[model samples]
Target: MSHTFSLSRVARLVGVPRSTLQRMVKEGRLTAQNGEVEMEELLRVFPDVKWEDDGEYARVEEIKKKAFAKRIFERALPDKEVLADRLFDLTHEYATAKGLLAHYEQLFEWVMHKLDDVAEAGGAPAAQAVADCKLWLRQQLAAAPREAERARGLLAEERAMRIVSVQVKVLPSGHEFFVEGSDTILEAALRAGIPLNYGCSNGNCGECRARLVAGEVKKVHPHDYVLKEADKAQGAFLMCSYTAVSDIVIEAAVAGAQDIPHQVIATRVKAVELLDERLAALHLTTPRSQRLRFLAGQRVRLKADGVEGEYYLASCPCEDRHLELHVRRDNRPFARRVFDGLRKEDPVTVEGPEGSLVINLDSRRPVIFVAWDDGFAPIKSLVQHAMSLELAEHMHLYWVAADLGHYQDNLCRSWADALDNFTYVPLWVDGGAPEVAARILDDHPDLSHTDLYAAGPAQFLQHLRDGAMARGLSPRGWHAEVLA
Candidate 1:
């Protein structure tokens, strides 16, 4: 006869959520009849389920019942040597002595009876035989701890010889992934093809912030993002900065549909032109089957001719199967190649469509965009995407650069001239200016109902954020992404 259990009971026994069991059933990993499941299938699905002593005893009883039949006299049992060996094996398998003793009490009694039977009827007394058995039992008990310790040492050695992996479960979404010893949770999730919200990967933006529901993790790196103390106290951590030490559950904000399903594709450069001496626009086309799907304002990792770097998508997603990237000719080798050496029809590997800078279409609040230098790349994409949405909310853009000539004022002015809901302002500030924040605050004194997005130098963005907070801007409403 086989033991059986219900789906809910199996879920409880395996320590997984009932919904997960349901999903397994839907996926055809499990089968049920009237909500009942066979014990064999349950064990097969989760082979690592640590059975308690009572559970082990029940299993043993089932095994014995299947192996034997009742008789008029008592059935012959295993010899003392066999019974003692089984008891030793049980002790080695179980972590606690209480459970082992409860499960093997009958076997122990049989061993004691065998010792008493060793004495002849007249030669040795039953009391002496009992005393000898007790003495032998005491000796075995005295060595039990040492034997357990030796067994643990062997187990530890075995573990050290193999790579260890820990399970991480993301809440709300119920996405699960395994993090190996050397990988961060964010890295593991991405490797497992799970899309998680993250930015700067170095832990500066707090975009990958998650709350730890349970389990231990060690911080792998330090983050400069100023997380609220209240959030810190409640177990918020940067997924990119921590590695799991044990199985863990984290409550991470799930990314929107538009923000996920990232991929790496080989794209052909359709055209390349110098926007100016410092900036070049590269047009790329993906293969018909591998057209990239990405939100406007996201960034991609571009690799060509042994050079790789991250560049923002300057074009709108409305432009199908094509991507436009604005590359700045900086001291970096990748930038130099893109600006001076790369040509049309060159094969470039593009990875990502990442960044948490996409617009929140649900908000009806007026929008303000502040861009500095090539920070305009993402801002350009954002504006284009917003325009395609046909949003009626008034939108204004402040374009600032080191020199007035670099602001791409003409391009923005064209949008202002073409769109009814758009306004563009260009400014040049060569050095640090206290008046920049003051001008913004003066223009938007009542920012309580506005959504302001500032992108540029880290220090400059921080300054603007501080000012925004001081002038009635809700911390949650203000969005800032630092450009390094």
Candidate 2:
């Protein structure tokens, strides 16, 4: 027999939010039917969710049924082997036996006192024996949280202890969190509704690296050179595996970002030019009344149906009446929206100019503009903005693109020549491979110490970040116009 089920049911079966499931659908990451999400898909995220098709609410009912079954089976068919194995792991990991022993004692107590309730005829004695062991194990388990501190001479310490809450100034996109029973800062932030920079929670991957500003913490678990002791002293540490005994403040710089004021304004696709079979230059125009004050390199999101994106603006900001974006012809079902369904004069909606790629008209800092691929958007903006401010000579530009031809038909060169003080360096990632950075460095090592600006996809921007950091560049001296 076969059955069909709704993904809504599947989402309910798991403890995750519906937004996560919806995102999966939008990204085409997880396959689902109109009213049917497969059991296999549900189990991928939660190994415990099961099916109960006896009713219309199959997955929901299934979750309750499964959890009930789990409780029942745990009591009925208690696994001494699994318990013993867990005991071994806990004993190896922690110096104290109380935690592991408490669980063991609980099981032991349940087995001896409640054996008859769980047993089937002759099984009563065996279950009772397990419970007896639990009572004996209880002797080894530590006292409760309240009592244990007294035994450790902490009761007197608590009498003198004063609790002070201080507000640490977290960055506009940074946050804080604490580790209980320990003073080690964790590798991830504790924001309620945001994704922290985390990779492996096992302390092996250093994905949640950040810097501490106030408060102190100690390491709880071992880390694999994710952060050196010296680095920690220098305000760098991992958040994933660290425990914060104190209310320490840390900053990831890009985390905890909040959405700013935004609105979708009517914009028209003004022109579309075929640079090549694989590339396109798209121009969009807003009504003269609705002037889009976007930077040359800033992008506005275009939404159709429900899909929206951070498409870079190719037109200089000086032309506030019109906007332009250059899109690579990615051969995908979604890509067809722009490459096929989209027309030169099609009505489009745009919402943004929300980024840090604009001209800092007040800053006297020299700018080193680096654009990888379609990242040329912001550099062009910076160039034009510099021209407007008559600070063009202070602006330096480097364009690194995957396809050199993409820059050919876009009329990018004419803008480059017209924009004073905007020097262009066009190099493909593969054309001059290994020495790309080296040659550029040789030509301009001043990037080693300048206000560097880079814009591109997450990976490209990350690469630039890593390279710049390796070359003794300070974070304050570096800026990025990243789109992900």
Candidate 3:
């Protein structure tokens, strides 16, 4: 048996920054005694446990790494998302028996023994790692009648012949859907395209709130952000807030669905060789068989296999068949792949043409598009699409890049020649352009009334929003993309 450690020691076992580990304690995100936290509590949050001195932890991690490599080598899966990695991570944390840590460890271990080697636990693939966890769980499960039935019910072998229907409704949109999972609604929704809006979907964000119209639901995780007495009276609930004790009908206010276009398809890519290193100007084609319809400046989700992530569309109606995706390699999961390993003809999927980040072309006053770096993707598509309709003329794009060579000459020179009304301004953000926005305001003092389409990091996007708002621009008149 191993000795329990303090919060500081457990924090080291988990990769969370010390500050966040501390917050988890203060916020009661995890339970602790005095200044000490169980290694097991830490494990429940993070599955891949590492002991400061235990050889077992390293051995398990190395084994997981090898399994991951083998999966990728066989092309069975792509890279894991930052959050998804955390799922399997929890499978490795262990606690001493009979303590608060016992149940978490036992439950995790029981799950490991009954599944295949390639199965995903919760949501991440950690079948082999989970298998190692079964020993202790099996013994305790035999003594706990109720939980034993619940755990066994989740496995196919445990109940392969049974089938059930589950209904779900998307909030705000009210777009209703259905699914059948071996376990919970959260798992089912993820399998379906609709993910419940959540931060730490473990019920921390209060972001996953929904209405439980009828039937029963149980809180699986200890969520203190319970529905207020008033809201609960009205039938609203948090999807991650509960597990259905009985078939449940609930409503959750889903995010990410405003003015989002329909049927976004993506294919093809163009390598902007002159752009920054590992930077590629991907010429994304809508479904090759059909034309993808989206606003010039909206975004879409890029999916490869079962894993999906999002990107903005850089093409417009005029460029109907061809879309553009400006991708840069910065070591983010699926994104890094598109920039580095993915190529033309590689099959990919696209979801809702999303986001409301575009100029109201009807405003019609030689609009200005301000973008930084790859943020130019949607702007280029919008400009191209708008010029074709004459709804846009005398359009000016002011872009800030690391340097001048970051842009392709054909893309620039062609816009100048083809659309006499279209203009381009490229600034070097790194070469001491004190403030690109300030430079633009200085050059075009008439900035007082120019309609702008801005997209970039939260800081840059907010900078434009604040400056424009401060200059007396109505909030509706100035548009910026919401990336967070």
Candidate 4:
């Protein structure tokens, strides 16, 4: 029988993004049956792929390691029980295949004996014909197919992948991520930049309960929140406490910006990075059990040394306990404190992740992000979020540097260099709002199919909105926040 793999598994085995595979299917360049791709079809579609080389997969893993520092790979391997279960499943499959091979061998022997009997009864002509047929069958069986080596490599790689990490698909929202190492479903989801609804991440509040639609799960952490017997029978489990043992489908909730609740987390000053003489990046780390939950592009109120100020988060939510804020050397209380003397390990209170200018997770259109001066803080967060999601068809970033002087210019350039779909343009704030807006808008004459996110002064945003609308951008496609 031919092997068939799910889209997620196929993407991993081929070292490509799931979105790329989906697009190929949509464009008729590839074929899939019921969301699974046959092994023959996969080989036909990607003939040049060197299945033995895992460069692409390794690159993605390194990127994830940098992005999700502590939450990723707490252990080098999965839990022992989960590993055993996976091994058991693989062994069962091997045994079944071995049994089938034995059965086929017995059938071949029986066929040979019947041919001999027919030859003995029918005489010399019939015996010669039977001998020729048996010789052809033996030759065909002995000759290896052209794809045999590549197919063997692919199967070996996929089996290794299955043992190391399991793919997960969330229902309703259709978001997919992989559970690697010893990560629970909730942890993996958050690391992927997906906001799954939960209260206490330790599984006391029961908010992380989800139903298993398919596959197996192993409980790695004990939860105080108890499920009813009926619920257990229905495959209900806490996402924060269970790790997947195989590729799984789950019915769970994906949160939007509004779905996240306000949180007051007592965080410590991890470091103070001086980007320029006029700007500083304050790094804060929350307690292990009480990580602040917020979407990208949101502003938080930070209080330190009896003073507080509101600033936009410059870090992606996927960064686990680490939170980053860009503080300009202004008269604001927190900015003054950060510039003056915010040492490492100092106490800081973070509260109210208040802002609606978040990424639209559902949109797959090309994105244009415009940031003015220090407004790049939120824009940077949004850009990282978009990168983690990998949902945008293309991304264009235009930074109109004013006082901050493109402090993170290298970072932007690195993003552009790393991603084929990303582009970065740094501009000087020479003329006023209209002139700058016109200059940026001049690049794209047609904005109807694009999503534009701009963070700047109110006047600049107004000019940008008016110009973009005039250039066929729908009102729904335009999103802006006044940073001034």
TM-scores of the candidates in the order shown: 0.47, 0.42, 0.42, 0.93
Rate residue 259 of model 1 by lDDT. 49
lDDT of 4 by residue, 286-375 (tens): 998888899999999999889999999988898889899999998887788899889999999999899988888778888999999999
Estimate candidate 1's RMSD in Å. Answer: 22.8
Q: All models: lDDT?
A: 0.67, 0.52, 0.53, 0.87
* Candidate 4: residue pairs that collide: none
Tens digit of per-residue lDDT, candidate 3, span 1-484: 3234444234324433233444566667877775556544544565443323334333433432331221111112212331233233333322322455678777665656455444554445465455555545566665776533433332222112112333454444443333333334664454333434554456666766777777655554567775678887887666654545433457664434442336645555433232557566566555534655456677777787555667776654434255566666666666667655676577677777767775463454557777777777777656654443334335777777752243554565456544445677877775343366666666555555567787666766666666666665666667777543
Best by lDDT: 4
lDDT of 1 by residue, 286-373 (tens): 8864556567678999998888999988876645466888888788877888877788799999998788777765565667888878
What's model 1's lDDT at 170? 80
C-alpha-based local distance difference test score of model 4: 0.87
Worst 10 residues of 1 by lDDT: 66-75
Error of 2 at 296 (Å): 4.0
Clashes of each: 0, 23, 17, 0
Candidate 4 stretches greater than 4 Å from native: 33-35, 60-75, 114-129
Q: Residue-wise lDDT of candidate 2 within 1-484, one digit each (tens)? A: 2223344334333433333455566567777775356544544444433222122233323332331221111112112332343344445545455776789778876765565565445486866765676666565564455334322332222111212111222444432222222222331222111234444545676767778777654455677755677887788877655554334566754321122235468888777777667666677777754555444455667765455656776655545355667677775433467788688677778887566565543344556777776667566555544443333234566677665444652334544443333456677687443345554555554454466777766666666666666766678777787654
Off by over 4 Å in 3: 1-276, 287-289, 403-405, 430-434, 470-472, 482-484
